[model samples]
Target: MKYRNLGGTGLIVSEIAFGTIPILSGDVPVLPDYYSPNEETAIAIMEHAFKLGCNLYDTAIVPEYGDAEIKLGRFAAHIGREKIIISDKSRYFIGDEMYDAVNRSCKNLDTYANIYFVHQVDENNEDITFGRYGAIDALNELKAEGKIKFTGVASHYYDVLLRGAKDKRVDILQGSGNILERGMLERIESEPLFKEKGFILNKSYAAGILPHFFRIETLLSGVLSYPISSVLVGMGTNEQVDQAMMMKTENYSRPSFSQVMSVLEKSFVPIPCDRCQRCRCKYGTEIHIIFRQYNYYFLGKDYWALRKLDLSINESAAQCKKCTDMSCMKKCPHEINIPETVQMIQRLVEIHIRKSLI
Candidate 1:
């Protein structure tokens, strides 16, 4: 596996990392499972990965729901405990939350994870859960006291991720930038990486749509890993582990101009609304907002936790209906047929709801 300075943290992470979300929660065959790894399976995967020189492992703990760290603790005990580097999440937790997460990570890993992250600090324009710990004031104290070796963040959006990189207190940054979540990448195109720090790129496969999976609908999904430094991936079974290890360096062939444009032309997925006004009244009407409203009215229960990402159509879509305008559709470079897509998304949401209710 190739290794890089990881944004100059003096820590050289393996290019091919074995992400442990599967060991935490087994969610999907393709998506990293969120369950804890079984004993025999854990031993097998860890052994294969280590044998191949892929040593970095990352896991996270949500206050409400997760068993990943506990399983990792057991795996660490089974293994030599100190043979690999561990990266775990500790986002936005306060006094008790920070203390509990710190203690849990140590106990679960059976050793100190070299790095602990503030998980999801900038999601939905929210303050970090570990606001107290995220600053130089607190983290410097903790580092001096040996609470954690290095501090960093795992974020979904680049606006916050970029700010985190500029903060001297923030030593590492992980973002969703696979072939699908390129939104983050586009934002950072002009800016430099966290010089002298690290940038661990996860979701390299674009969730589950990459490699060995069919194309067409899985636009956000991909099998290709970009030319980025380190790409973190998860394995649920032993066979999958082998593929991750033995996979040699990819011979990348950048697409021709037409090919690139064609791919971009075909690969646009509508941004789900979260009631945020980021789009403003630009579309001359609310497009995604309209979809979100119809979604809730039509498919309410099916969207439970998904509600966190809903976009409000009260203004945008309502404006669209009031005026003889449809500017958002024209501005959409993908030619998404915005009005139709929003309506379809609403339709799909209702269909899911109807299935569940029936």
Candidate 2:
């Protein structure tokens, strides 16, 4: 496996780092079958990743009810301390409780971590991540005292995350970006302008939705074109891991610009459902956010993001007939063709249901 320079730091992290979330709650519908993995399988997968030259592993303090960190640390211990570089985080406010959270991560990894991430950030709590009491100061203190190698943030909100990216003190940053969530991609040309700092690209599989519109080769091809130095893929099986490894090398190169454009041109627009409360969608349709559903279907098509939304538009996935046309799309900002998109999603949902059932 090839490695890239991490930010301005000399650390070389693998292109496909591992993310350990046994389960994700809220706005998400499906969880990977972490339950099916015995301790043996989990151990094997971790070992396999390392054997394949994955030097870095990322785990959270509260990884889906505590199992992930415990298991990860145990694996690290078995694998030998010198073989891996670990990164972990506390998704809490940085002050007061931050150090204790980090200590817990160190203990769980059974070794010291190289980078300690500052978890999540958004509009309401930008100060939580950027202020003196946040990860920046805390990390600086720790680094001065010889606790960790560097610091960074993992954010979900793009705007707030972009702010984090501007901070020179922040060593690394990770957030949601996928083929469907092209919003983040638009901001990437400025990546070189990060004043020489680099970010790690997560959600590369679009949380698992990119494969919908494009063929698997095409999706993986586009992923390698991202500007960030590292991209993480959560692999449950060895086949998935091997396929992901293929994205890093020159042997499996990216699709050409026209190849990308041609694939996008055939893409369908998202369904029409104004988030406005004026026209209602029955069957408990979240009239507002399903646009993300359609966007996920087309642009990024990350299954994890789609599942994260926890949206079930219809009873059987073919239930678009549950609502009449509210014409909410007519008032949208960009003059989007809304109703047609909803119908398209309805059809897609049925297809999803059928494929899953089979």
Candidate 3:
């Protein structure tokens, strides 16, 4: 396994970081799968990954990731905390809340996190997170106090991450990308501002759906082709650890967006959004995120994706119909029919919700 510097932090980490979501014992509905291995089993799986050279482990606080944080602390103690780098995060947006969250995470880990991110930052909470006494400030204070070595901003939206990149307080950025949704990654590659900060990419397998349509090496190679510090994969078993870590590193060319779409064509008509976040909604809806949920529903996250779509699909569709703005389409490089696609997804949600009731 090849090691890479995590930005300019001077910390060396494996190309593949261990994501602890799958190893958590719980019925986390948001998660794609529910494989709750016992503490002994979870430790063994992580230990296997460690032996395979995975030094960076990422987890969140309790209730968000269930007992995974505590389990990670136990594993850290078992393997000697100094031997590994821990990356922890919380969903709090306020300064006081975020500052307290980091302390709680330290207690859960039984040691300091190498990096602590303000996770899932988006437009709704972007102001509070980046504003005065926001989560970023809290992280900065924590860094000064020696609680966490680095401050990170993790978001699914490109704009949120761009702001984090521009902020001097942030040391690392975490985002999602895969072979199918490589549009954001493409944009990040073209922008020089992102090169100054470390990037850790998750959702490499599109929440474990792409693996069914494409080979593991294909997904890993495509995402790894970009300039990033690490690719986080949630491994639940020893076999999963092997599949994620043992990619053929030599002579693997990154697959083009067209090639990725071609493979998905065998399964279903995937929305060509690529999640660039170029389309802005005046109605305060996340158009790209909704489109992703539509694709995810068909890709095996049926109920979970549907539930997310149900939250704003009707309202967003209504907004799309009432508005006369066509800028969303005009700005789309793929020229996707924004209104029509939204209506189509709305119909999909209605159909699924109706069928489930029967």
Candidate 4:
């Protein structure tokens, strides 16, 4: 297994870090079978990953219903906590809630986390993040107490995260970047500060959008080409763990950015939206998120992904029909028909929700 320094944290992590999300079972009622492994199976997979030289483990509180943290804590205790690097995330917005979340995580994990992330910061909640009683202050307080070794932010917004990195506010940046989603990649290449900091790349599979055979090899190689510190994969089974190890050990040529991009463009039907967020909906809709979730639903064809889209659809569906001026369609740089796409999603969401209920 190959190891790299996670940004400037001084912690040497495996190139392929084990993400604990798949170990969870029945956490999301909408998708009970979605990556849900039994406790024994989950532990066995994680132990196998450890045998393959994976020392970095990531988990979150709310998403996993605390099951992941509890199980991981038990496993860490069994294996000796000092031997591995454990990272966890909290989704709480306020400082007090953030503090409680971290405390609960530490207690469950049986030790202090190596890195504690302020999870999912984006343009929509930038104000809450940097506010006086926000996650930043909570993380700072935790760091002072020696409850966590470092503070990080996992965000989808490149520009917002880049500002934090430039100000030296965050020690690590966990962002999504793949062949199709290249925002984070663009920032890393152009910004020296971000390149120099600790970066852990996630969503390399684009929520399982990539095909299986070339998924591990292509995605790993593509991410490695950048100055990223680690690539996080939520390996659900022993075979998946083995595949990641094999990809690292094998001497295969890594695909260049252009090559991968060309393949993606040729293989998949083009979606006009580039997620530029330039198209302003008259009803205050988040068009980019809608399209992104649509892509996930199209590729994954899973209830969980569909359910996520349903939540967004609920917010914007009513407003979409009221706007006949089509301002968003005109403003889109890619000239995508925003109203038409929203209508399609509305129909799809209804169909899927009915099926799930039945």
TM-score of each: 0.71, 0.71, 0.96, 0.81
| True lDDT of residue 273, candidate 1 | 35
Report each candidate's C-alpha RMSD, comma-separated, in the order given.
6.2, 7.3, 1.5, 4.0
Candidate lDDT values, in order: 0.55, 0.62, 0.89, 0.75
Q: After superposition, how far is residue 232 of candidate 2 from its true place, in Å?
A: 0.4
Give the poorly placed runs of model 4, Cα more than 4 Å off.
29-40, 62-66, 249-268, 272-283, 302-358
Error of 1 at 16 (Å): 1.3
Cα displacement (Å) at residue 274, model 3:
0.2
Candidate 4, residue 211: the lDDT equals: 49
Q: In model 1, which runs have C-alpha deviations exceeding 4 angstroms?
A: 25-37, 62-65, 93-96, 123-138, 193-196, 212-228, 250-316, 319-344, 347-357
lDDT of 1 by residue, 299-321 (tens): 32224423422444334334445
lDDT of 3 by residue, 1-358 (tens): 7787888788898989999999898767777664789999999999999998999999999879988999999999999899999999999999999999999999888899999999999988999999999999999999999999999999998999999999999999999999888889999999999998989999998888999988899888888889889999999988999999887686545787788778777888989889888888877878888989888877888778877888899999999988898678878988899999999999877875548746
List residue ranges in candidate 2 displaced over 4 A.
22-36, 63-65, 212-217, 247-290, 296-358
Best-first order by lDDT = 3, 4, 2, 1
lDDT of 2 by residue, 31-124 (tens): 4433335556777877887888788877777543246666777777889876787777777656556677777777766667788877776655
The best candidate in terms of lDDT:
3
